[model samples]
Target: MKTESTDANTSDQGLITLAHGAGGRVMRQLIESICVEAFNNPALALLEDQARLDMAEIAAHGDRLAFTTDSYVVDPLEFPGGDIGTLAVNGTVNDLAVSGARPLYLSCALILEEGLEISRLRRIMASMSDAAGVAGVSIVTGDTKVVPRGKGDGMFINTSGIGVIPQGVELAASRCQPGDCVIVNGTLGDHGAAILQARGDLALEADLVSDCQPLHGLIARMLAVCPQVHALRDATRGGVAGVVYEFAEASGRAIRLFEDQLPVRPSVRGVCEILGLDALHFANEGKLVAVVPREAADSMVAVMREHPAGRDACIIGEVLDGPAGSVQISTLMGGVRLLDLPIGEQLPRIC
Candidate 1:
C-alpha cells in the first residue's frame, strides 16, 4: 500500500469535507478508527481497492453472476414517495437491471451519527425489508457504525448487490447507430424536484413527489419485445441529458431530440419555471431512455404503453451521423440548438 503522508492532529469536524479523500495518514486514521471498527468483517478486513466477492455460495454448475454496489445519502433522509431505506434497495436493483441481471442478494453498510433516533432507524429498516421483499431480493448481511453527532450526517447507506445475467440477454451502450429511435418510460424531473422541494431550495412551492420506483419489470417487458435494444440507461443522476449524451459519445453518433416528444409533468414544469431549472436536466429515479432500432420502434412503443411502468412512453429523439458525439434539440418553434451538460451542482443531496 502507498503510505499516505500527512501530519497528525486531525479533529472530528462536523462535516465530511474533502478531507475524507485526502488519502493521507489522517484519512487512514479515519477509516481505521471509525469505518473499520464498524464493519469489522473477515472479508472486508482484507481491505483491497476492490471488494473480492466470492461466488461459491451462489454459483451453480456453470453460471456467471453479476455484482454491483451503491451508496445513498439523500438529504432529509426521507422524501415524498420513499425514504433512504427504499432508495438503497431500489437503486441497487436498478443498477443490476441495466447491467442485464436479475437481482438476488445484497450486503448493507450503515454509517449513523450519534444521537439519531433508534425509532427512526427501525422505521427505515422496516421500509427496507418491505421494499426488498417486493423486489424479490434479500439482505444477507450488514454492518453499522456511529460517529459523534457533529462528525457525521444523520445516516448514510452503502449496499453491494449480486445477481445473475441469463444467457442471450445483451444490453450495451456502444451498440447505438444512426436512425435509431430514443424512447423514455415516463415523465422526468420528479426525483430531483422532490429532493429540492424537500430541502426548500426553490423560491416557489408546490407539491412535488419523487418518481422513484422499481424498473426491473419494465425493463424485462422491453427486453421481451425488443431484446435487440441498442442500449438502455436509467436517467438518474444528471437525468436524460446525461444518459443520452453518453450514448452519443459512446456510439460516435449525434442525437436529435424533438422538444415536444420529451415528457414533463405540469407540476414539474411549473416548479422548474419558477426555480430556473431545466426540467430536462432534472434527475429521475424510476425512468429510463432506451435506444431501439427503427424497424421495431412502433411495435416497441405499443408494447411499452401496454405496461404500467411505460404507459406514458414516447419516442423523444433519433440518432444521427453528423458532427459525432453532439446532442442537438429541435426547438418547439422550429429552431435548432445544442444542449450543454449542466455545470455546478443544481440540487445537492439528490440521488
Candidate 2:
C-alpha cells in the first residue's frame, strides 16, 4: 500500500500545474484524492497499472469479449444535458452495446490542461462515476496527464470499454437485407443543436439538450424481443444519416429514409432551418438506429417504446434493392433525393 505524500499540498482550490503530471508525490495524491475517490471500486483501489479482471467471471457472461475505445473532445466541456465526462463513458458503452455485448468495465484516461481548475475536474470525474454506475460498469484503471495550458483544452477524456457478447448473438452491417426496416430510437440532431446553442457563437437559443445516455439496457431489451436484428448503430458523429450510409455500403444495398418520419424535435428543426443545416447530417449522442426484418419491425419498435430512452422509437425507412451504396430520402414534397455524406466537417469537436 502507498501512503499519502506528506510533502504535497492537498488543497482543491488551486489550478492544475505541470507538476501534477510529473511522476511525483503530487501526481499520486491527485490520483488518490480525485480519480480513485470518485470511482471507488476494489479493482481501482488496487491502483495497479492495469485492471485484472477475472477471466472465469467474464466468460460466464458470454463466449467472446468485445472491446471498444473512444475519445471525447466536445467543446464547452459542460453542455445542456451532459459534460465530456458523461459522453466519454456512454459513448464507449454504446459502441459495445450495438455489437450485442453487455458492457462491463471501462478505463478512463484524462488529459487536463495546466491552469485548469481542480473544482472543474472534480465535477467531471463525478459525472463519469455516475455514468459508469448507470451503465453498470466499473472504472477499473485510468491515467491522468496535465498539458501546458494553451496546448490543450480544459480537459479531454478517452475511454476504453470491455464487454461480453453472448453466445448465438450476432449483428453486423453486412447482414442487412433489402426487406429490412430502418428504425431510430428517438429524435435526431438534438445533441448537435444543444452544443451549437451552448457555444453561444451563433447567438442561438433553444430548449435543446444533448441526448447523451447509455444504451446497453435498452439494447438488451431490444435483443430479447428481436433476436434477429440485422444491424445496430448509435447515431453519433454524423447522425442517423451517417449510420445508414455505412450500412448501405457494407451490405451492398440502398437505404431510403422518409423525411416526414424522422423524429426531430421542434427546437432542433428550428435550429437547422436557421443554419440551413439538415438535421440528418447533425450529430447525436443517445440515439440508436436499428435494422430488423420487416416482420419484426413493429414488435421491435413496441419493445423500444417501453423504455424511456426509446419512447420515440419508429421505423424511418427500409432497405432497397436499388443502386448499391446509395442512401436516399423521400422528401415530404413527394420526391426522392440522394443523400450523400458531407464533404467536410459539418460540426467540429462535436463528439
Model 1 ranges with Cα > 4 A deviation: 1-63, 203-205
lDDT of 1 at 34: 42
Per-residue lDDT tens digits for candidate 1, residues 1-351, read 322223232233333334433565545554554444333455545655545555764564125577899899899898898898888888888888886677877777778776565446656767887778778776666665657767657889999898887677777888889999999989989899888878865664577888877788788788888889889888888889999899999989999999988899898998888878888889888888999999999989998899887899999999999688999999999999998988866777787
The local lDDT score (0 to 100) that residue 164 gets in candidate 2 is 99
- lDDT of candidate 2 over 1-351, digit per residue (tens): 343423244455778899889978888888888889899999999989999999999999999999999999989999999999999999999999999999999999999899998878889999999999999999999999889989888988999999999998999999999989999999999999999999998877578899999999999999999899999999998889899999999999999999989999999999999989999989998999999999999999999999999999999999998699999999999999999888886999998
lDDT of 1: 0.78
Error of 2 at 255 (Å): 0.3
The whole-model lDDT of each prediction reads 0.78, 0.92
What's the TM-score of each model vs. the native?
0.82, 0.97
Error of 2 at 165 (Å): 0.2
lDDT measured at residue 260 in model 2 versus the true structure, 0 to 100: 89
RMSD per prediction, one decimal? 8.1, 1.6
Kindly give the stretch of ten consecutive residues in candidate 2 with the minimal lDDT sum: 1-10
